[model samples]
Target: MARQPVARQTVARQVVASPVLVGRDEFLALAGRRLEDAATGRGHLLFVAGEAGIGKTRLVTSISRRAERLEFAVLRAAAFPGDAEATGGVLLDLAGDLRRAADAGWRDVGHALSARLRDPLAAQGDPHRQRRLLVQDLADLLCDLDPGRLLLVVLEDLHWADQLSLEVIGRVAVRLPGRATLMIGAYRSDELFPRTAMRQVRGRLLSQRVAEEIRLPRLTAAQTATLAGAVLGRRPTGSEVAAIHGRSDGIPLHVEELLAASGVPDTLADAVLVRARALDPGVRDIAAAAAVIGRSFDFDLLTAVAQDAPETVDRCLRELQSVYLVQAGADAATFDFRHALIRDALYADIALPRRRQLHERVARVAVERGYRDEFVSAHFDEAHLPGPAYWHALLAAREAAAASSHREALPLYRRAVRNLPDGSSPDFHATLLAALGAEAAAVDENAAAAEAYEEA
Candidate 1:
């Protein structure tokens, strides 16, 4: 799940209204002009970034609505928090749009897209030319979708997007110049630091100087009060506003959660758990298992981790949805916790032994399904099953190194060594250290390389 920047803290107060999007007049004005520009055949790339719960989605929804008012044909797609690996997952959300456009005479383009994206459920093809061809076709499709009206494509939660999805969007942004289209991407800024696939996407786009980025700032105390007033239909007392701002740090989601979860629990996790406990114990158990599995989890995966019958998990999910704890994903079989904070709370509240057990199940199921090496390794590490953890870590490290992400591979190799159980073969430690040393040397971290070599 996309994480909150702030440490766990209490939700502000117990109040509720449709989310009040305050203090973004300037951004909305800028967005309006960009839409007008798109209508005039001047395309744009707008990057909206902020920390979790800072109203990134609310702001973009506002932009989309404004664009609609201007008669622009808008298409929206969002990447699942931790499960965006399906091929063209974001673009595939527009399958309905593509079909409709086909019926309206874009048949050849639609056929081309269908052929290229024949198996949207599978991983994308690896060849550069294949990806470029698909991206080019998609871009042309966008321009032709509604030749007279401007087209607005909004990709949300990009920090969770797969590399192929990011690459496709980046390519579209570049090709949209002088076309009647606007591309907007929203991602968590806090998650894009130092090293991440999303950072690489941003780097390429920024280098081209083709996109304008707007980083949403935390709300000011005054703005917080306005937001609170709008939600409650009455201005807050001065003390209440101060409390909200202090606890929430002016992040809209935090403020909203705090307001809705009044009674002032000491931490956000506490508030979230309080709500979870209000649901059926069975439902809550399912939720905890889902969190242990991953934020964005499928029905089959949850059932496996829950060790329960499929029907049982489905019933629990229905109960959870009644409380707005989890919502069905783009695919009805998949579900996501409505908020990352809630998942954090549930996962954190699980007993250590139970967490280990659940993680072990997740690792076993992932290995059985031939899931990505990183996920398999991650669950094993969480399970603390030293032998399997160590071996999977090594595998994950090799995968990362093969991708030229040597810096990322280094820590995985270190994890392999750290998790080596007693009586392990001497060669195990030697091999792990050798891998670590190689990665460190590749990154020019000679001291690290020497240390690993000495240990080996």
Candidate 2:
């Protein structure tokens, strides 16, 4: 048999830079121009897709922002995961004015289809008729609303959208031509499967020559570094930037989360686990023990946590390093997990009860190392011993609030509440509830705050 040569992998070049929009200029310009053309009554429907963290939402936001500057009327709606079967969700979001217009009998089609639009179930028995009715009604509504201004409709997370929502989008897209409208939809291409309703809807629109697609690729290493600079307010060291890029794989959300972390973070733990599962049993054990110790630990500490002989731990470390899972840190005595996500994956793989025991052991080690109250509290909380965790959780919540990290404060407040024994500290419990409500309100989770206040 003839031997086939292995193709070499392409390595991305590292480019140092000051802060800039990393990898989306061309796409943004194209979208901006399309919206401008729509202002001239040349409507267009553009589809953007990528993986979850690939910056689809950011791109949509950027285009919408630019459209607003150009005097375009932009309307936005996002489909929720649980509402994947919701009918008219996006339509209702964009057509709030339609209800009033229908009530006033401003247009014949709007008045005729108002009942169907309001009650999706009423028209469910006849999908073909309902689709037609909606298509005409929407076209008429847009025509009536036209006041020599472009209308930009943005639908995000289309993979989570229901069948009727997708159909309505497709129908609207087909009718958008020669009208002052531009429709843009963003979906997670990775999550969308063949033969699914969303795919069918997209296919139908594309076949009609009514929609075009733009797929967002992962950022290059240089682009990743540029993004990091924007977050850090200064350029990161080359190695630090490379570490982030390696871990994030150029995913925007992953990069941002890693930048936001005050310590080694496990933001991408679930994604990293897919690759971490390849480790051998012994090496995996060493990795898990090292994770419990911390993201960075000395060889002696690893040996202590793993309870393995120095030589055995050495062998496992060498094996792990060979797989690019761990690397020598500041010196030979110490090493670091290649990414916090890898540590998280290894730690998460441990069974729950054993995990709690490991967390307890970690808490003891943290105490010996003179770690901060919050660090120790987290371990104790994980160990299912909430006594020590309660007071520390409140202290941590105060620290987070003082820093104006209100989103971060909410979890600490939640932890404080969860660890408190019912009726044992009624006054303290009320205080925690009040703090929780305040933090929740600051984060725009008003409903959650209302519920918390109601409970209090």
Candidate 3:
């Protein structure tokens, strides 16, 4: 994409001297104007998209620092691959920033917001409303707190941002114009894929004219030299600059990593996988893992089954929360996939072998954690572990019978009988058959009950 012309005297020239900022003058100047517009109540969303190591983070830092000079309230956070879907991950960071910043704007907004954020969301039957309220609270607070006082919200690594967080940004962007609230987001363009949350939110915002995008290209030769010189604190020889530029390919992060090693060559690395078509690699992985656990999942169980860190599990839940693909359950610790179809979509993507492995993992973890016998038995069955499935099914059947749930006991008893291992003693088999016979008779399945009694 063609970048706008760099201003004659770039705002970047006034930025703190740093090698990364050398050829970044054009972007800084463009960002500078946007910041000015925001400060003057022409608030809106501005996205900076580029490859990893392309200086997005540095650019965000520079923009945030400049916003601070404009007396704007600045909130900054970065999303990681695994933690992008968390409902509260990014906001938690933002609120923490506010508290640490001790900004007067935050004081006016009150601690209630932060406390509420830390506390579990109240059980809401309407997750759509819950999500809207989530975005609205944060958006309205910044937009309405003090219109005269500008606010800057910087979210970096948005390529990995969760749906809820992106939703918040989109909602905030809608309220930015004439509100002195500028939301600056940086993301790895290389990471965005078709149907990804970033792509969808970004496209919609641009289409709505509530957001603009700046796509950063690698540094030019001369600009690369300038950065090399700045890092060396002296004029770099022509050969030296050319070598650095050649080795790093003008990617800012690569340049820094190489330069930091002094004369020795240093290697830099960047890698990630993405989506069920559009899902962020991290979000998609978590989704696939969550799907294997079943339609409904609790945070603790998901963590165990997903094998992702707890925070990542939470963030991904929020991402699914954003798309209405899933809904938080009656309590903070649980949520349900919005529908079986969506779960099936996620589930189908899992290869059969891995699917079985995941089912086994979920079953074992659920069993250890004292989940309902039925839940454990079903997972074990899906995992093809008939022994445990039968054991759990029997346990469930007995529990059902004790609770006077004869109909439920009938099914569970059948499951256990069908799963009996070939080596079980005849007497043992007959005992289960007799019990099944009695339960079937109690439920008035006359022929089936008589058949079971005859077998016993």
Please list the Cα RMSD from the true structure of every candidate, rounded to 1 decimal place: 6.7, 20.0, 17.7
Q: Tens digits of per-residue lDDT for model 2 on 87-183?
A: 4445553454344443353344344444545543344435446546655555555455455667788887787665556665776677677789898
In the range 383-403, model 3's lDDT, one tens digit per residue, is 888899899989977865543
**Which run of 10 residues does model 2 get worst, by summed lDDT?**
9-18
Candidate 1 residue runs with Cα over 4 Å from true position: 1-19, 68-150, 160-168, 200-204, 309-311, 390-456
Candidate 1 lDDT over 1-456, as tens digits, reads: 211122222223333534657999999999999898989889989999999878888899899999888888777777765433244555655554455552555455455556555532233555344446655666665556656767898888888765556666777787677789998999999887554557887988888898889999999999999988887788899999988888888887677656666554556676677677665566667888999977678899888888777877887787666556677875668888876766877899999999999999999998998876657777898998888888887787775565445555776787788888898788977877888999889767799899999988
Global CA lDDT computed for model 1: 0.74
**How many backbone clashes does every candidate have?**
7, 0, 5
Better of 1 and 3 by TM-score: 1
Q: What local distance difference test score does each model get?
A: 0.74, 0.69, 0.69
TM-score of 3: 0.54
Which pairs clash in the backbone of model 1?
9-268, 11-258, 12-258, 13-258, 13-259, 14-262, 15-259
